[model samples]
Target: MSDTQPATSQTAAVRFEDFGLSADILRALADQGYIHPTPIQAEAIPIVLQGRDVMGAAQTGTGKTAGFSLPIIQRLLAHASTSASPARHPVRALILTPTRELADQVADNVKAYSRHTPLRSAVVFGGVDMAPQTVALRAGVEILIATPGRLLDHVQQKTLNLSQTQILVLDEADRMLDMGFLPDLQRIINLLPKQRQNLMFSATFSPDIKKLAGSFLQNPVTIEVARSNATADNVTQVLYKVEEEAKKDAVTHIIRERGLKQVIVFSNTKIGASRLSRHLEKEGIKASAIHGDKTQAERMTALEAFKQGTIEVLVATDVAARGLDIAELPCVINYDLPYNAEDYVHRIGRTGRAGASGDAISLFTDKESRQLADIEKLIKHNISRLQLSGFVPARSMDRRPRYEESEERGVQAGRGSQYGRGAYGSRKEKVDPWFLKPYEPSAPTTKADDNGGAPQSSSKPQKAKVAALLGGVPKR
Candidate 1:
């Protein structure tokens, strides 16, 4: 059944109390200051409560997590036990995310929603010691949130079992495919019981996602709270054309011009994210970077700092683009346009959350015209191209040395460097004086034998060179 009817204001008027959820769940919702369900939540909660499979699609910041989580908790409460034994709290609901950050965020939401109830929830992902997670798993939890790789790792270690998992949620299924987690997903899905209810939620739906749902879900109800591949209506999007070398300077200038206190600058690569973060810090802005290359603790620390207003800007890769819920983020800057058009929706979605007005500022170079066009095509509209007035480049600001140093650490020489002509910048390599010396031949000295027959060499016999084991480099 299709739940694609346009959500009117009437839906907005619907309260969470009307769902007939457990008092504990309602109490937890109240504690979080949430009363009314968002459109997606309003639609999917009831369907999920009926024990039906769900394929849910909604733009970011539409409360998709609670839409499925609240119902999953409600369904699992009937079997929830207060027993301390591990068997009493078997993992009944399992949620999988593509990245560790999203997994942890979902875990937080799940823990908050189920806190007042007897249900126990635990989250497990890589980049941390597994001892704690193993202990928690052995202690038993009714709801488990994890990434595919770590989930499989625990399974291999015999610390987790999914045969009894009665409900499955693939949050951000499209991103999982993009991150090459399809095989891991397939392996995890195979371990679960065939009769479990399935729920797949994402901001955008693609052909691969549909095929995945068809394979796993048994006639799941399709729920679309917004148009497919649509951006948030509350976000104002704009693009500025700049030279590739000037993008970092533009970012700094934008933050300064607007006096933005809380913003996330999205980069297409981890190195780019780190570099931009360093630049902002050098410009006297409190900023941090998070990406796949960062440790779980580091990423979480940066996120917590950003949320607590300790950091003004958080430069990040796509790992933080999805499932990052920051209240009234105000704005998000794109240091580099995303390679995938769908990612543009998610990147901007970091801001303008929950009906809050936000601005999405993007910096695109001439070479990224195709990426910009793709983003515009996906959103079904042209972004407002604005000129940066009264902005000065870093070179003009007499920061040419800093620019040159950053370029040296960037792309290799002879390549089309974004910052400058080459990392060396017309500098010549220094030659060592030893290499200029001419080669000379020396006559071997011989020792005369007492027999006066043939002269014996004075030098000792040289040992034959031996090859290293395992086909490694040979000894000199």
Candidate 2:
């Protein structure tokens, strides 16, 4: 019932060979250096083989793809067909992802894991021609990995059919929901046969996610490998309390000083990614930016370049958060704290992958204090402070390294608390005397003299002006 508890298979068979995986799958896994099953893999694979709905939660880099892929491949190969009809291989499995990168990644893994098997798999996503995807569909494929929008497009074109799908997998379900694909996911789910096995995988199991799983899953066995939005322990996490102006230097310095070859730096926006990349280039670092503005081809090209070690640093937005798998990536830098706290886990997950030790570095400013607090609260672990050699926060801020403590105790501006007193040094906070006083009708009395003995009512008439350009009495 709980993902934390080791499954019977987990305790019984810690190695991949003991899982009774197809020889083909075992060979493929061995080729990929996958000797041991991850916790999620060990737990979920057996349940998936039993044909049960699985709602799984784990931190990023917990081998989720293999957990689902291995069993799905085994199940498909168990019923391999010998018919020669083009439609004989009618897509029996459909994997829905929010982004094209993930679709491609999952399909590659499926193909790799099923290398020695005769199973055929194809991937379809947006940002490419429909004709090629249509051609692939016409030839027939047993497994299809796709994005929701593009799948809907193929449906509209009468080129793809989910009616025969026997299994459904929503990889990164939380991300799909984050990308606003829940309605599209529901639409796709409606197209598939309701009796098919359903599997939902995500890094976090929020209430919304549980609700989403409830709508389709048939008494799913919940597998929570880690706490919701949890990060991995293998990653060395640190926070650099930096000034806004010093962020660029901090990132470049970290990369150069650490001698990190492969790094993914996450920014809050497209412009931020581009700007940082350009700055990194000026500092002699081979960097590239990937975001929504780039075409699919361009994004793929940049990602490939980064993966190939041609691009030293991959600067990107949240679009790459759910996908962008780089094996043994050394470090991940957060140029800006994520607006959503849960994303912090996803961003750092990029580095600590495949059981490899990695580093998660974040640049923080006073402005990002709230975001930092939110991240700490969601992860339930405070990030350790890291100081840069020969680099202290610019004195303009005159602020100490902050985590959640300041945000918790600090009062709002103009309230009963310190606002800019210590940091601004010698500059007192300007108090609005008029705003401080509560509004009340003036005491009705005659106009009072300097002696404060008597008051007199002297009414001043207001001047009238034209109300329109055409000329008219403004008011009575």
Candidate 3:
């Protein structure tokens, strides 16, 4: 089944009233100026409201958050009371995210939806103190949105409880797995009650995601609003094949030439993001960097500045690229190719939101030809290669040579060194990198004792005499 075709597109445009949502929720939607349901919302809301497991796949900016959040809030309000009683148990719903920004965004949506309702929600993530989170849990919350690592930490510390959770939602599951949170996810899943409802939402689902969904969901009602890995048709995508050294110049030229404002530039690494931001700053373009390495406060400051238009360009890693709710952002630039092909969608998905036209530009060097090809394959389209004036490569048709012999030698050396014997011990055989090995502390060593006390060394006590015939000095 494809997500592109709506099962009931011919049905007259759906209103929030058609979904039979609670009065408070409908009121909130009206406050937010949402008059009609998006395609994903129109289809997924009814199925989720029925308490069935749902697997939804659609590009970002399709209102998936509201699709699930609205129903979740409605269900919670119907089953639970908001009388402000101490007996009102907390944490009925748990929403897991891959990044702190997304966690906060989800929490914001939940709060907006539940504003008129008496239900309470809180967002928790790492890189911030735990005292506030602990207090929030103690006070009781109906919905808890958290990142996986911090959630696991709370579980380990007994600061949060998930035993009473009736609904579990995994948002951006693909990105969570990509960040190596599968183990933590499994741990969290094992702690939850097995009979509770499961909702897994992702922009794209690969084979691995299907396997994970199979393990967690039972006869899920799959709702896909768009084809998997398909870029939004509303986004205009283009690429430039420039020399490695001319990328920054090309980016600057394009920004000025196109008269673009409110742009997000994606870099592969934290350092690269900072470097790009600095370069843009030197060129008199205000910019900032947001990544895992930055403190929570700093990242928030940068985000606020970007949102307020104090900064024109925001350079960021993939963590900031997902689930960002910036309205009407005009452009997204790929300064560095993503290691994962799926990330291209998430990165560019930052733009073209809310039924607005957006532009996505990619810069590729000869070294990144394979990565470019992978991106094109994932999007299932050939991105038109454009040549920017003053930034074209010196050698347009140059192909980098393959260093097969050097690669073979490096592999051989790695095998030899890893298998070679050392003074401590021999290497373990067939070590799987995926396995998490426990750490073991070594025992302390003791020197020999003399007469029940520690041994003492004598100063200049012994000397080696040289033979007289050699006429050599004595050694001590």
Candidate 4:
């Protein structure tokens, strides 16, 4: 099947059934309550089924996982011979993710999609015992979803093999680069077969991502569902300027005032996430923090509690929350602005998933104005300004100009002095030490003709002349 164009108003809508999927796979979709294909899915499925490489850019809630997984599953099933058994191959497809959470989520989706087929899949990640992963590989699974670190560990141990992999997916390729996993990704790509299909998906394609794609992909089809760095149209963004000290109070106030039932609050540091969660809990709002430091059990427990409404808020670092799938989540709070501008899209993507309307709130301190500016530039939209009642900013009272704005005055004061202002009223001129010395030459001393006698030392010490030369030597 060839790739199909996006549906127009007069055209009939394309359903998953129109893609020639197996009966069992369609049954699984029905069980999951999926009737229509998302935009990414509608465009990517046909091209992928045609055995072509696809590079897709879509926001978080666009059902991109199914867009790639469903077609891969159907193609694999179509190629499977009736007499062949499912356990014959140890692996035929490999999916690499940046974080363990995303790996597990993708693995779950692949498993769910391939349920009716006679294929098996497993997920491998760090922060757990490797013996189980080894056992699963030995049992001969067909698909493997893994993180770069743990997957490399298995490859080095000679326990897992990728010689037979037919499809390769780098989900969230931008995040992989952000976590400094480019070298690992390259190593894994080197291990896979050269003829395999490649699919790279991300919320935003940065310059580094473009460079990576040039190296990995062949002549491929590029599918972009929205503009670059653009957030979902359904999400409403707002910013609150507050002091650094009173940020927690402001967040708590907003939650109480709005009566938000479920929310995800993002923090930059692990300690900050934990501290904020504790403060919220003390203020009678149930919350928990999830980060890389937490054990697998602890992370899973917190996620389950939050999903079940036992916890009202989740305080998470960027790495722990990427690729988290929560249905009907309404609010996302940037308790701390992300260090990277691209992460703003992924963070807010957790809400407004599956075509649902949502809201994102960011708390910006006076010091974080530049970060906020960068975010605005990336998103290409102005965030609505908001102020809380009874909250007065302390730094707002200071009329001191920003350092960047005072560059001219700073330069006019001095060239090499530490203090901006000189001790005298005028600027001080720097003095060179070599300029204070007199010149000397290495000319031979003339002796009297009558006496070839040795020259006697002068009674009075003659003052030594300092050399006057540019290259540190006297010219005769």
Candidate 5:
């Protein structure tokens, strides 16, 4: 018993003011200068405000945050409080994300939207000191945004309570499953009251996501702004085939040739992300890497720097880059094509966001043909393959041998005119012409002996034999 609402082209005619949202919410939207809602927001905001369980599926950057955040704020404002007592603000709405970045991003959105209202909000995640989080939790907040593990940690420590939480939102449910957060989700869900509103949103609607939604949501509305596993229409997708060893150089060449000022390069592995970041830095690009190996502080600093234009390139892994909402990101380069075809969709989704034109460029070697094909099949469209013209795969000059360096310097200083005998010493030696002649045996001397059959074998002189018995034998 679920309602299916397909997004329409007419959604463009809808405005934020028509949603019947509160003046506070509308004022906050106006503050951010958001008058019109994206397709997902147009469809989801009204339904979410109705307090019905919702299952939203949309492309990554089509205003999913505001779709749920605004209504949740409007609904929670009914119970909003200005009391000074900590008990006045109990966790009423809980938003769970798969990654810390997403949690932090969602928390920022919720805080901004709720700024004009009395609804207090807070976010908690791992990778940093929990002292600050514990303090915030003790201070009390109505809206709590957290990753499942961190939320459970706070619950276990008794610093937070969710028994009175009224609404539960699972953002990026598919990613949570990929991250193996099902058990955690179950545990956290068990801790909440069963009579709460459930809202789930994901980029793709896989079977596992559907099953999870069936189990968790009660007669929810299914909202799909685009087809499942669909790439954005505005994104220009292209691929460049390169040799394995030349992939790094290909990235540098592409960036330099295109003069791209701001872009995110997605790597499949943390090590690959870091390596690409270092390579770009060496190539004189302002680049930084964000991955699980980096501390939370370092990741945040890099993200902030990239957003502020201090870093031109933000190379990141899938997990680290999940839920990143960068405004007007012009391009995304896939340093390594993702193994999972669905990830390819998410990778490219980083660009072409919010109806903006973007380029999704990927560099793949021969070995990634299967991955490429799978991605094509999943997206139901062929990505244009282009040759990387003028890409000569830079060779490392630092690896030159010592002798070569000295020889080159000598030649430059007029020490030698040629590479062979002058720069390096002569490599040739003198040889005798006699030793070069073919092998020949001398003729045997056979003179006047006409009767000699074999020329008497050419014998040499022989010494006389000694007596068999000496002194005593003579007397005998």
Candidate 6:
């Protein structure tokens, strides 16, 4: 559980039976060909089975679903009656995911693990038929996995109840915040019982996550399967410095030269993803864009096509890319680098899953130096630069931060620095030498005080020589 410890290896020697799981759960694991327990599962399971809250941090494809779900299902089954029908069971466990893809994946794993048990569970999310979700909720189940948005919709529609939920799991908590789900999470938590075991899981537990935990979780046991926000060790990061207008050419080159068969190209925005997908299509590559605007059906169809090699490339925005469980994906290309450094970690995480080797290539323009720098600092490694034969960038030498360019320069100006130089070159800090030079005020020396108290100046400087030396203010 310590941060310095190595990632929970998939090949850890621990066995599922070592944990106090039910026979049905062990049977299900054996059926799934999982004889060994992953580090997260081995470390967190016993604690979870003890009914204590847990904050789990692990990278994707690290068998985290089993880490919490196995214990949860086991605990629920321990309390369930053998004679009671599942249709009358209360929702004892609640797992909330940020995206529909993740909710479905978690639901599938829960079902698979509980295949032999008497427990029943259902998944609900947005962008699909709610009638089916409502029907499933109406039939009492022990577990409910849902996305924040769709779960709230169910609550508002009077089709679901969380008051009876005994266990709460926030899977992918960071992505939930990234997608603006904090408010929704609070609303859902308020609906749940006051005393319930809370389990929070994320690739990274940033300060915001800690604050969320403070409010929701009791004194919790922390488990770190991998360092927070750390990129997968199997992912090879590659950077390409290209002119802004030449990113299209660079993509085509990477695909043709490296013979990349299937790649997920990430963009910073939905519109950018759509544009890049169209451009790649015109460049003779089969491509499709996936983002929040696209319906869940469309996103799933595109993903399925990409997985089956029907589409060579899939372009997507950051939020839209969450919960994309693509295994053995050969490569991930950043058509545009993400604004958040942590996103770079998650973006490349899509590839290099389940201990498979993969590549993460990012296209960088000189104008995006700051965003690029942020990624390097986050992962704590500089990506190796790859200069293609025909795509040498024209402005690749500009090392200035993103704020030094165009509209952002004005913001830089407001800071301490002056243009491109050192801090505070303004006149207030260093008075102009011309004004500070030896020069007396040119005023009427003997004009008896106008009001009999003091001498007054009659006229201003005529030739403007003294005035120019005094910063255009006539000496009186």
Per-prediction CA RMSD (Å): 10.4, 12.3, 14.6, 14.8, 14.8, 14.6
Top TM-score prediction, candidate number: 1
Regions of candidate 5 where Cα sits further than 4 Å from its true position: 1-10, 395-476
How well is each residue in 283-370 modelled by candidate 3, as lDDT tens digits? 8888888877789888888888889999899898887667788889999999988868998999989999867889999998888989
Superposed Cα deviation of residue 12, candidate 2 (Å): 8.0
Better candidate number, 4 or 5, judged by TM-score = 5
Give candidate 6's error at residue 391 in angstroms.
Answer: 4.6
Clashing pairs in 6: none
Q: How accurate locally, in lDDT, is each candidate?
A: 0.87, 0.83, 0.83, 0.83, 0.86, 0.81
Worst 10 residues of 1 by lDDT: 404-413
Return the TM-score for each candidate structure.
0.84, 0.80, 0.80, 0.79, 0.82, 0.78
Better of 3 and 5 by lDDT: 5
The clash tally of candidate 6 reads 0
Sorted by lDDT, highest first, which candidate order results? 1, 5, 2, 4, 3, 6
Candidate 5, residues 1-476, lDDT tens digits: the string is 35445433445778898989999989998899999998899888888888889999998889899989999999989889899777999999999999898999999998888889988999999998989999988888999999999888888899998989999999999999988899999999999999999999999999999889888788888899889999999999988988766788898999899999999998776766777889889989999999878899999999999999999999988889999989999999998888789988888899988899999999998889999999999999899999989989866443211221111112222233333344464434446799999999987544335675554544554446556675542333
Q: lDDT value for candidate 1?
A: 0.87
lDDT of 2 by residue, 1-476 (tens): 22223345356358988778888899999899888888899999989999988888888788899999899989999667667676778899998888888899998999999888878889999998999999999888899999999999999999987788999999989888877898898888889897999999998888888888878888788788777787888999999888786898888888888899999999877767887899899989999998777888999999999989999999988875467788889899999898888888888998888789999999999999999999999989889996778665343442432222112123333212244445434445668799989889976435666888766675753356546776575564
**How many pairs of residues collide in each model?**
0, 5, 0, 0, 0, 0
Residue 246, model 5, lDDT: 79
- Cα displacement (angstroms), candidate 1, residue 95, comes to 0.6
Per-residue lDDT for 249-286 in model 6, tens only? 78878888888879999877665677778978998989
Best by lDDT: 1
Q: Give the alpha carbon lDDT tens digit for every residue of 1-476 in model 4.
A: 23323322212387889888889899999989987898888888888898888888899889989988898888777455333444575578888898888888899899888887777789999988999999888877778899999999999999998998999999999999888899999899999999999988888989898788878887668888888889998999999888776788888888887899899999887767887899899999999999877997789899999999999999998889998898999999999888788889999999999899999999998889888989999999889997777665344333322122111112222223333334444555557889888887655554333466777544455557887667775666
**How high a TM-score does candidate 2 get?**
0.80
Find the 10 residues in a row with the least total lDDT in model 2: 401-410
Judged by lDDT relative to the true structure, which candidate is superior, 4 or 6? 4
For candidate 2, the lDDT comes to 0.83
Supply the global lDDT for candidate 3. Answer: 0.83
